[model samples]
Target: MSTAELRYANQFEIIRSEEKDRYLISQLSQQLDELYTKLFGLNNFHIYQPYLHRLSELLYYLTTTLSNRQTIGEEYVCLIQYDPITKRIPSLMRRLFMIFFRIFGDLISKYFLTTFLIRPIAEDFFHPKLSLQTIELITRFIITSIERTHKISFYLTGYYYNISKILTRIRYLIYSRSTSESIEIQSNMNKTIKLLSLCLCIQHIIETYTSLKQVALSISQHRNQLNLIAEEEKEKEKKIVSEDITSSTDYVRCPLCYELAISNVALVPECGHVFCWQCIHTWVAENQTCPLCKTNTTQSRIVHLINY
Candidate 1:
């Protein structure tokens, strides 16, 4: 095989190893966090929840920077960081910088920026206002974009799984062994990643559509409410000018059934209209308004009057 092909193969193996290690670390951190919360109680865990990223990053840093030891993933893949400049393993100072850089940078990007910067700005000045779903959709899109970009870069350069790796000028060197095992593992991982990506793409599209539909519905409801208010005002003026013909001359009669309001007399509390109990009940169930005055009402508002 050509030198370039060998280098690409090594880099691909390194990427896969790093990703697998990340998954393991995440699972470990979640288990530890759950155990901690269980031990300390849920209420106390709420206070400690904000520092979850810190805990995970600290664990990652410690594992990756142990004295004279490659990270677990690196060892698994028979890989080590080599400095081309010195033709040897990376210097201690450089390794420390890389560790701190990855940890702090992730914390800032994932937590601090979103909490302090993006959310506040979005809440205050976004035109038409943004809903929680819209914000979540935006966040998901941003994450998907970053992952796709990283995948493209990995395919093109086969150098860095993480931006921190590039920033620290780190390169992988295989130890005294063939990379056949790592290559096989990576191939499987790649297939799984592609399937996951497809699922995420479908989810993103669905969420985007849902958010937009919600926004449209909100706008439509607002407009309908305003128009209804205007129409109600006009109706009120007309109702006051003309008395209800059915109840004008007969107060002890139900307008709905045109019968004496003697059996189960029901009162419309809002407009002082009277009807049979069954009549008003059925009217309110269907119309949800006073038959005479057109006032808004409900079944609960239809009070039954006692013949005292």
Candidate 2:
């Protein structure tokens, strides 16, 4: 291979390795980045802080729909310019509103947005210009997001390794103690140490999350197997059940209650268990299986048996 090809191969390998060890590297990278930040007085990187806002933008939507407020982009601006500027909503009330908004958002995005809106629109006009535009937008957005995450991850990692080299070059200044170091200097060191501790906690939490996710997946599999086993057992029981022998040759009787099916409606369930309408309905409502075979059955699976 040429030099350029070899370089590209190495780059690809690095990318693949980084992706594989992304989570593991993040903790080290974060701590090192913070350490470098403290040593060199780097600006604290703050992006998308969710805690400062008591209420979300959903409040703006509510205001627009309920109180005829303008659909202003900014939440703070919307709140201030409103007629109720003098009135102050309680902290508890704001929290309650936030909770309600979260629930409503989940429900709407799950059912209404996906089922009613997105599904219909996509199904109807999937091959049209709208879909093309949507696809392009989504593709571009995804590419951009991936690029940003990659850049940040690498930058942090670089900081972690690069800081040592930088520190080694500037060690003279760091080691040289001229006078009493300011309280702020001590505070910065403390903060840096605390941040490194936090990074450790974050890594542990991530590992725990991965472990818990595996456990949850295993539990889900077991639950599904249990359901399947229950279904099979129900089927076996349904097969073992003796057909109800009645006094007359013309009519079949329900095994349960041991009586001739007097009702006009005859119930033949999916398990081939013959029963009276009311009897099967009652039985299924309780047991959800054929009385004889223990086979799985439901109200929907029950059919009417007609004799000529």
Tell me each candidate's TM-score: 0.47, 0.21
For candidate 1, write residues 1-308 as lDDT tens digits: 21323233344577667877788778777887888877886876767864775677667767666365777787778777777778777788878877776767654455654567557876676523445555554555455556556655565456776777777777887644336775677778677666665665676567667756765575465557657877999999888656564446367688999887765798988998889999889889999999888999999977888971
Candidate 1 lDDT for residue 157: 54
Residue 36 in candidate 2, Cα distance off native in Å: 48
In terms of TM-score, the best-performing candidate is 1
For candidate 2, lDDT tens digit of each residue in 76-187?
1222211122243223334334335432533333445444654466567442223333433333433344334434443333221112122222110011222345435645
> What is the lDDT, from 0 to 100, of the residue 11 in candidate 1?
48
